[model samples]
Target chain A: MDEIKEIMLDILEEMTGEPMVKEDLDLNLLEEGLLDSLDYVTLQLEIEDRFGVLLPPSEYTKEELDTPRRIIDVIADKMAV
Target chain B: MSVRFYDGFEFFVLAAILSAPAIWLGVTERRIRGYGIFASIVVILFVLKDSPKSILLLAAYLAYELLLVRLLLYLRSRGKAGKGIGRLVIALALLPLILSKLAEQLNIGGFAILGLSYMTFKSVQVIIEIGDGIISDVDTADYVYFNLFFPTILCGPIDRSRRFSADADSVMPKSEYLQLLGDAMTRFMTGVLYKFVFANLLALAGTDRPYIYGVYMFFDFAGYSLMAIGLGNIWGIKTPDNFNKPWLSVDMRDFWNRWHITLSTWLRDFVFSRLLRSCMRAKLLGGDRVYQACMCLMANMLVMGVWHGLSANYIAYGLYHGVLLALTELYQKKSGFYKRHKNETAYKAVSWFITMNLVMLGFEIFAGHII
Candidate 1:
């Protein structure tokens, strides 16, 4: 979980050009402008490459995978399944 | 007769006279709603003067959007909003703009409305955001203001509702107002220089026709955007910029980011992102993500192109850039050489030269030089 979290944060920072703190994990990524659709796509690619878990982009929404917390949990569930 | 620098001069004088009270209110008390309202009226009148029939077209379009949005909201309040409903609402919102473009192509001649494309973009955004539950509170007055904000009425930086309203409703301190005043003056003056002097000189440049025309257009459009941003600042609306130093871009994607910054960003957010997501979910490209992305890029750019006009050249220009962007992405991904040499000065210069020529060729196509 921590490794996934680290990878996601690194991608977020790269995409947004801003650092992400722990508190940012719970915030609405889209609303806060921390992530956009393009960034979301890039993040998904990064996640798939790292975890070997392919999360279909259309199967989720910005609202669904909006935060680092939510994203990590979703990935964990997908992996479990 | 199109509006010119001389008319712009008169417009400034007239606008100052009409908006004096609003300007005073901002300076003395920081109030802006009165200014916003007055500014909206001025633009409406200005546009009406340009083409009186546009008023009717605008009214009908606005009526359609407002009714559709309210209806969607009511349905959502009743817990009836679903993906199908959302798609339907977006389609309806797009109908007028689509029809206007189609009518122009067919020479039907009556469907044209000033700023219809920008209005459609804003309306679609409102519906999508509302459907997403991102925006729950919709004020009629604010929506109207966003629709007809004077500076961006014709060509736009396409300010978002939430961002626009925040600036629209805020009270800037006297110090900040003074700073804003200085900034506005600088932008206005620079815009005037770009449009009248530099662009006009380039237009005169039988020195080399195609090269001059391409670069001239950059100045002309950038000048207009700067003027709009300047006026917007004075009116207390923080209109976002549309251009950066686009000539310096090293790739198609980089060029897009710098040139027409707002439109490209809008298409990325609202069009490409959504299209890509849907394709991925449907497994449309048979699990090859790169191929999927390439197809999505073509689709997205083609839509953007058609938005300019339903013409062969425009579509080709869009497809050209789409292919270039996709190929650039593929190269960046596959070529380890790019990763190593990308940071070097000589490599960057060579890349920039290729990107600019490609962009110039696209502009030539857009200018209807071919077909």
Candidate 2:
């Protein structure tokens, strides 16, 4: 779970060009004026590239990207698949 | 005879006529079965009203689509892309575009007259996405509707063929149909206000007034974009917003983001970014953010020139914008001001004013060219 969290944060920062503090990281990234819908797509792509897994583009919705838990959970589920 | 356009009088006349039971009855209800029948008549009407050449044009467009789709299937069925096939696809897609624009400029050949500006970019955008494996499966009807989308044919927001198909194939509810129709009408009325009212008034007032002259462009173009969006809604389709209060922008980047937004996004995705990346790979540019930023602006403006049509004034406009982007980038490097700014809205507003002025001047130059 920590590894998943770390990976998602790294991807977000790279795309957003904004740093995320350890305490500040959460679903707030979506609503807190950091990442946008376009950045979400980039995040999804980056996850697949990094994990060496197939995450079909359609499954990653804007709602899903709003939280850390959901994103990490998705990456874990897809990797297992 | 003096040609009279649909003004207040004509609009009321048109609305009354359109609302008459005889007009849209077949389109709206029990005669909903007449949808395809109505569309066929539309095609036939254009062919007759415009020219016999429209028949050949339609055939040519269809053939081009068939060739593009089948060739992709053949290539993919064989195996994954071998060698530098990406460049090959771009070149192939761009061939007609280059020819079409060059033809328009050189006037050496007959005009394609089939919305080539809109269609060519759309075709190229689709193929690029497909090449990137962003899209894989699409059928013949999707391809046809993307280009032949009627309202956008005459005037365009230059919606891409692939993007249109992707959105169209998605699930749609019957409930969405009524909402979409209502939305279309409301949006269409807003467009009418923009085009016939605000833009018309500004141009009518005279270009000597600097502010009015500047704002006229926003009204004129954003009006057309609204119309395109409205029409797209009617078709249960929608395209990207091509304007975002561009006149209110204060810097070149903001201006680009606001004005002719679809073209700007399209160029950034397909042209500017590609060029900037290539320049980076060639070692012709530095790896740092500032250097990369400069390269991006340069690449962006150069393509911006070509996209507007290969003309001297347009090229100059592109260069002018490139200089603005480069200058702002230099300022950001020196001041680190963009970094410290927490209030993005304030920063954007300041940038907006500056950007809009620059773009308006470009419009002035374009207007001058016509005069």
* Candidate No. with top TM-score: 1
Cα lDDT of model 2 by residue, B1-371, tens digit: 11112234543343344334322432343222123224533543433454667557655765775677667656766776653675686677667768877887897765465666677777777676666565666677777667666556545777766556655655455565567668778877888799879998998898656667767877877777787677566555677677887656655655677778777767766765555545544556454545665767776787777767787777777777778777876675567677687258887776666666666677776555433
Q: Tens-digit lDDT track for model 2 on A1-81?
A: 668778776776676666752345464666665653234434544675689864433334345656656677777776666
TM-score of every candidate? 0.84, 0.78
| True-structure lDDT of candidate 2 | 0.63
lDDT by residue for model 1 (B1-371), tens: 23322245666665566556666766885777766876676657664776777777787788889999899999999999999999999998999888889898999986678788888888888888888676777788788888888778778878778788888888998788778878988997888888888988887875246677779988888988888898778777788889999988998878988898878877876788778766776778686656777788888888888999999988888888889888886787569999799889999999999999899888888888876
Pairs that collide, model 2: B249-B352, B249-B353, B250-B351, B250-B352, B250-B353, B250-B354, B250-B355, B251-B351, B251-B355
Best by DockQ: 2
TM-score of chain A of each: 0.81, 0.69
How far does residue B315 in candidate 1 sit from its true spot (Å)?
1.0
Candidate 1: residue A62 Cα off by (Å): 13
Q: What is the DockQ of each candidate?
A: 0.19, 0.20
For model 2, state the Cα shift of residue A5 in Å: 3.7
